[model samples]
Target: MLVTTPHQDHSATDLPRTGPATEPAAELALLRGDFEVHLTVGAEAADALAAWAEEHGVKFVHILLARGSAASQPMLTLRASGSYTEVLAETRRTARRLAADGFTVLRAKVESVPWAEGVPASDADAARFGAARYFEHHVKLLVPEGAATDGLAELAVRHAAHLSRNARRVRPDGVREQFVTQRCRLVGSETAAARLDALLADLTAAGHQVASAEREFVALDSDETLDAGWIDEVAAVAKVAAVSTAA
Candidate 1:
């Protein structure tokens, strides 16, 4: 996906591939389209009447029926899709209908449906979940008020480049499917946060923020998030490549 470079000053031209290596023509095809809409809608019956009331987004909705008429099962799950702007407009319209019908609704939950999982609006969408859930995060890094503020520009440059490597796009929660990852090459959020903290140790209380809420479409079998262990994969590949070269 083509992302707007967050800042003009950062140039990360040699960023590594997140997706597989592709022919130039294949890459062009990937870029020549708008991202179709993908997000999940969650709402529940406030009472028996609302529970059975014809659900909004029903065509796209995943009905999580309350165990019995008055019972609570898990929660509502509706997956909506279409052109980006139109899907959102339609979802908001559906949400309004649900609220009016008396269902308790959480804000729409955004999900990243990767290729292995299948495309949005598939007949099998109801049966699929992604390899892992993704987060659309906003990070705040400021110069320490009392510390040397001279490095803020440099740090900002690095941060912007880092974000580009990890995410599909740099956009807001509702406009959908945005992702955030650290550029420091450190994987854990806590460790990454500490690195930012130590670097900014003074002045504007420089640190990071996890300002987004994440949701998954289905029960994830693993807790994997960051690429903390990527080195092993790279090392294993390099070892075989080296052997092949020598042979």
Candidate 2:
């Protein structure tokens, strides 16, 4: 990704929007095996994200809430096999497709959950690769030479529990497997969002380049009641970030 230069202002298409025009989300992924993928492009891309999830069995909070953009082409059929080998191949294909789709590709990778090299020896062994949905909440920046470590450290410490799916999967009837934390992102509350925004603005004033700093509300895919859990998680996300920044 181009770090030194400021990110382009990704203009939204005529598609319905869930938030401010300045904030738009685009996503593409395959949720099978260890081939999980999640990414957000321009706000215009949310059009595709919304339509594709409903068409396929995808789980996404942003798409469910989004309303403005027009109809968009779906990227991939979500009806993929759970086999590790099959999904791995599909994930590679998915990444290639994304690269050719005009979006900038950064560190495209396919990894095994338990860190195995070759295919599993038995059906049971392969199950350890457990299916998961991939997503991340990040604030990319180009700080001073020495500041990179601190920035990365802060991200490592705080962004893990910040955002959740950027994903919307259509599950089969009556399937109720609880969605665990594959990972998380963004400030949770308006106050935290404003504070983080202020910090980024201050960084700009001090000559630091912020490539992207987005705020994501709390999200989870589960059958249980989680209203309180959501609030606590969001608050925890905000607190960790603030503490990390202060340190």
Candidate 3:
């Protein structure tokens, strides 16, 4: 369940004169919303963390390799998701377990804002929202630094054609074409998960090194409900894709 700190009573004169009232409005309600908990773990612990999430059926937004950190150890950002309460609980549990195992875990809370109230009141709000939804499951097929780009153009053409059969650009009328020219493509959650095998096979066969992929969900609308199943599918695919890249 979502919990909020109780607001203290204040006189009207004590409220700000230049802005909205300080008092919590009755119309302002808290809803059980989705959120992600971020934690940094060393490279030695990355595989373990990923395995734990898979074993426990936890969903993850992304896992990023932290660069230029002061620590000698390679660091990674392990992001886990759930409702506010669940994320807090899971983060604490995972932190405790990993710490006991001698892994350094630094945790941070990434809270979700109320969609409607958070957006700026402007004419571009609709465009902003549309872009958000379309790129909700955006994944990047990264090429390793210093890797050969010799065949990249031809490979991208072939890959784009393959993706066209399964993906559609967020804005079909937009100037940029997916797969063909743009490396980033918008795909359905299920489609992305289902295409992992083919994607891996194609990229590897083309002498392309897929170093890593990032995944995240951007809400289409303020009130959009997250699909736990879709999140799980993404999490699973991400894990497999990461392993494939390492191999």
Best by TM-score: 3
Candidate that beats the other on lDDT, 1 or 3, i.e. the better one: 3
lDDT of 2 by residue, 124-232 (tens): 4323322221222234444333232443333333333211222344335433211112132221233334445545554556555556654322111111121123213
Q: What would the TM-scores of all predictions be?
A: 0.25, 0.25, 0.30
Q: Global lDDT of each model? A: 0.30, 0.33, 0.36
Per-residue accuracy of model 3 over 1-247 as CA lDDT, tens digit each: 2111234223333211232332322322221345434444544565676665565455432332111232222222234334433444444555555555566653333333323223222324324333323222222444443443446444433432211111222334333222211111244334433444445566678665454433333331221121111122344346556877999
- Of candidate 2, the 10-residue stretch with the lowest lDDT total is 218-227
Candidate 2 regions off by >4 Å?
A: 1-35, 61-85, 95-247
Worst 10 residues of 3 by lDDT: 221-230
Question: In model 1, what are the clashing residue pairs, if there are any?
Answer: 144-202, 144-203, 144-204, 145-203, 145-204, 146-203
Ranking by lDDT, best first?
3, 2, 1
Model 1, stretches more than 4 Å misplaced? 1-50, 53-74, 116-247
Q: Write the number of the candidate with greater TM-score, choosing between 1 and 3.
A: 3
- Model 2 TM-score? 0.25
